[model samples]
Target: MTDSLTLRRPDDWHLHLRDGDMLRAVLPETARHFARAIIMPNLVPPVVTGADALAYQARILAALPDGMMFEPLMTLYLTEDTDPDDMRAAHASGLIKAVKLYPAGATTNSASGVRDFARVQPVLDAMAEIGLPLCLHGEVTDHDVDIFDREAVFIDKILDPLRRATPGLKVTMEHITTKDAVDYARAQDDSLGATITTHHLVINRNHILVGGIKPHYYCLPVAKREEHRLALVEAATSGEARFFLGTDSAPHSDDLKENACGCAGCFTATNTMSILAEVFEAAGALDKLEAFASLNGPAHYGLPVNQDTITLRRTPASYPEKIITGVGEVTVFDPGFPLNWSVLPSSV
Candidate 1:
């Protein structure tokens, strides 16, 4: 049996490195393995302007502990008032990689997101012109739609029309959770790609509401049924360039997460590589792990792959159940099964 594996260092196509203490606390967990990540900008005030993106990027670099090497590919949160000139400037200067579209009230700190898609048409057009990608949260927040049905409905009601309107605009649907999403992505061309999260691959809705409520497994665009999870596994392991790893390793303190109105996220940064290794191996697609985790994302974002390499060996993987931060203790994601492949220390 194969006992050791090595590949080009990976990149997180979608990541949340919240500002200040939380950023400092979680940055290392991801940097320890990933070479770069498309950093989310849904902070309290959001990073909407070119100036805002620059400032946020500086804070992220400053928060990085010495001796570690990682790049924060910043993103501007798309808003109704977003300036096309500012976005083009950011992309031209290499200050930001993409623009994130969070439908109003869809997820955490999305109060400032777009309520009217038409208002942002100019910005979207500019993005297509400059070849900057658009990252979508991929859910509609309408009160009438069932929580589980929001993704599919959003595709029909919003995404389809939006893509149709902007033919050449590149798009990446983040943290997709359903078979419907997979089929839609498959039907799209090269300009469209999708990210599959670590948690979504392992847990279904049952993991959240089965015997009891499991808040840690809960996240925005919440996990779907077993069929969907299986579909995600197949797409990810299929070695398709259109799908890649985006841990979406969102963190919330224990106090905030285990409460009456808990936050939406799963902190998987600490052990994502090991968990992915175990997952890829199980599907008998160990050969495709590098393509899914390392190669696909950079190709999608038009960035060069990292020259460095990481090696994984057959060994029991162990990680902390909770990570302590200046804000509060954040729980690490529990993948349910024991992870047998651990990244070798030298690979870091």
Candidate 2:
């Protein structure tokens, strides 16, 4: 059964490989595992234009280790004033694969995000016409909304209307954490899909605060209750095309994560596929793993599925206490245990 679980190479529908030193340090981790990744654009200044995205893509390519085959699919961070002309030009140039919408103050380094959906109507309309996917951070920034309720609230107040306003727009809800999000993605047309992260599938909100404040477990669209975690697990293992892998493996220097107000994100890109294999195996759905990890994402994007294959073995492995960076080492969300599954070399 372990030998039979191997799959065609998978693409990470979502990933955060920070620029410069961090980018160099982490690119190998994700590139080692995923054939491609939908690179997030929430950099310090944010990649708000076609030019910025193109520049960022170059940096990613430069950072990759020699002999590693990894494609970094670029995305523009949409701002209220983002020019529709620029979006169309980017799509035509094939430099940009999608546009990411981060509502202002929605998550880490998202201060430059859009202040209102209405302000980006023209850009959204152009994307719909051009067939470009709008990858969303999927959380409302209202201060009054409960932290855990943000995903659900955004679905009701923002996503639904955005879908209506821009009919035929391709949307990928990134890092979905709740049952409401699961049901919403499933109900939408085939153009709409969602990315599920490794952390949300294995840990509940309680794991974040259980014995103590485990800052490493913290991430935006914070992990919800146990029931929500189970729902996410079910969705990922259900062989449903709407649900696919998106590590959203954001990395923050330890100083920032442990400070007065730690930023929101997790650095799980290193062990992402191993963690995912473990989750699906535990769910008794190993047969569906390949579809969730490999097929679903590219299918929704109208891209060809990867022909290369990768293997997953139920082998033991350990995670580091922290990954060193120039600024400071970043603590990883080590399950404080060994992983039950690991990826191995494979030939399709």
Best by TM-score: 1
lDDT of each: 0.93, 0.88
- lDDT (Cα, tens digit) per residue for candidate 2, span 11-76: 998889989998988888888878999999988888988899999999999988898999999999
> What value of lDDT does candidate 1 attain over all alpha carbons?
0.93
Q: Which residue ranges in model 1 land beyond 4 Å of their true spot?
A: 345-348
Q: Pick the candidate with the highest lDDT.
A: 1
Clash pairs of candidate 2?
Answer: none
Candidate 1 positional error at 341, Å: 0.9
Q: Tens digits of per-residue lDDT for model 1 on 1-348?
A: 799998899889889999889999999999998889999999999999999999998998999899999999999999999988988998999899999999999999999999999999999999998899999999999999999999999999999999999989999999999999999999999999999999999999999999989999999989999999999999999999999999899999999899999999999999999998888889999999999999999899999988899899999987999988999999999999998988864553
Off by over 4 Å in 2: 1-4
Question: Residue 318 in candidate 1 has what lDDT?
Answer: 79
Q: Tell me the alpha-carbon RMSD of every candidate.
A: 1.0, 1.3
